[model samples]
Target: MFPGTEAQEETLMMELSRLVQEQVQGSSWWELRGKDCAILGLAFVALAPGFLLLRSSSLLLFSLGLLLLGVSHAAITVKGAHLSSHSSLTRSPLLNRIWAVFFIEVCGAFSADAGVQAHIKMHHAHTNVLGLGDSSTWKVPGLSRSLYLFIAPLAVPVITPLVALAQLKHQPLLSSLRTLLMVSLGLWSHFWILVHVSEFGSTLSALGCMFVTRNFFSLPYIHVNIFQHIGLSMFSPEQRPKRIYQMSHGVLNLPRNLLLDWTFGHSLISCHIEHHLFPKLSDNMCLKVKPIVSRFLALKSLPYQQDSYLSRLRLFFDQYQELMVLAPPITELVGIQ
Candidate 1:
């Protein structure tokens, strides 16, 4: 929908490239590795305090434990697992795979292989093409707005393992069994940690703590996931725009939420548009490149969509019938217009 003929598109890309080069470069190999290690180390540091606090008899101490544990979970899965899935944390595939196994499968309770395929291969590749990267994964039309946004997210901890198990049907037997074993090991080890380190009175107490801590950040997690993509321009396959236009039109950046920023990274929050344009960049790099991307898009008369999280929450609540309960109408973008 931005003004340009097909021939002008190449110039747009080149212009953007020049602008990018003028900006800061991407993360170095060593920096990415170090970044990954630092985040993992921080998660463990928080986890130690979390476990210790959980063992205290005071209600305030138990609540502190829940908060620390939630932050640790977010660090591992939201930041570590997401970056690893994109191969943004390392150059070597073996290193990326090992990191993914630990962060995505073991700590995050999802199949690493399935995550990469679903996210990078499909979602990122198909940004807002309907039924692809449209954030359809968060939809539940049957639920009312209150339940869909507020209540349903509480089941995320339970749903994650089930979804991981279900993806097994799509993989080869060896991969499935391996994923199954890793997931089981992760769940079992976490349960053991709760009982041994946290000093919960019984298996039930451990389970309850797990449920509470895991779901602590679920509301924001779900909110941020959907707010970035849903209600944006959706394209049918035949009428899809070119890559730049499509992503610009469909993707949105939410004003940074510190909790989400630390947990989910700038890729999923403040620099989402830049992340879509350059998926391989590290979170810090994405934040670094964001200004250049935004300026170039502005100069080119292309969209640089952004809105606040609460505004989006309000929008969804007001327009739930159209945005969630039914399929939004496919937008026919005039290419090279």
Candidate 2:
């Protein structure tokens, strides 16, 4: 676990000094293009294999197809949609929104409306607050911790959009209408292929497997999400500071993990501090900036939290009780404070 601290005014100067040194002296257009292409390239790779797998008539082939579909979808959800929504993967509003639909709705079978609501609105704003932030989704006031971890991820995806819809119906007319249209379209497309597309085959087992595969992806997707933010420092609304402080304080950047970081980009776990600090920076840019960010934190004698994937995974499960059930004692609130 990382230690939290308060920075003196002079300390802030040192942190920023390292941040400047770490940046790619100057940004360029190609750097941005390269990242956008990488994101699209990965998307196509994930999607093409699934299409090929689905075309096969054999059950074994189809099962493999479903696995591919789930893995690709997970990558989009974590790597593509999550980062794009934050505008951390690209700059174009049009491109980010398009990726948003492809990832949140089409691939992940989740609504962009709810994802924004939970992630950008609630989670980013409140962070680890008791009931306001999306972190609360993992909490089970009275239930056993093990059961909560198992069920929370499975339940959130199904219920989050509905919660978003209900919350927005009377709020913004335009936003509400757009959300409804997007959600309806997304659900329609998913069911249409599963139920009516004859080529995909219509069978109880096939349909069951589709759902089962979707559910299976949820575990890791949720694990990464929770592991990145839940067990970290948090602060109340009243204690929150400037946007930069709020972002840089609580968030920690774990070391790059091979498969997970590649799929989810540096923003998922690695360079996470930079992502929170500068949401507009592309994933590649975040990776480029990590050394600067780490040095800044380190010079200030702060822990830029990082751990091996296995170690973090173990910590999550081991501390599930305190993180989700009992809640950590408010020792040193970081970002929001």
Who wins the TM-score comparison? 1
Give the alpha-carbon lDDT of every model. 0.84, 0.64
Off by over 4 Å in 2: 1-30, 57-60, 98-102, 106-111, 129-134, 155-157, 168-171, 194-198, 203-206, 240-249, 333-337
lDDT of 1 at 136: 85
Which regions in candidate 1 have their CA more than 4 angstroms from the true location? Answer: 21-37
lDDT per residue as tens, model 2, 208-249: 645655665566566666676666666665565444455555
Question: Against the hidden reference, what TM-scores do the models get?
Answer: 0.94, 0.79
lDDT of 1: 0.84
Report the error of model 2 at residue 249, Å.
Answer: 4.9
Candidate 2 colliding pairs, count: 1
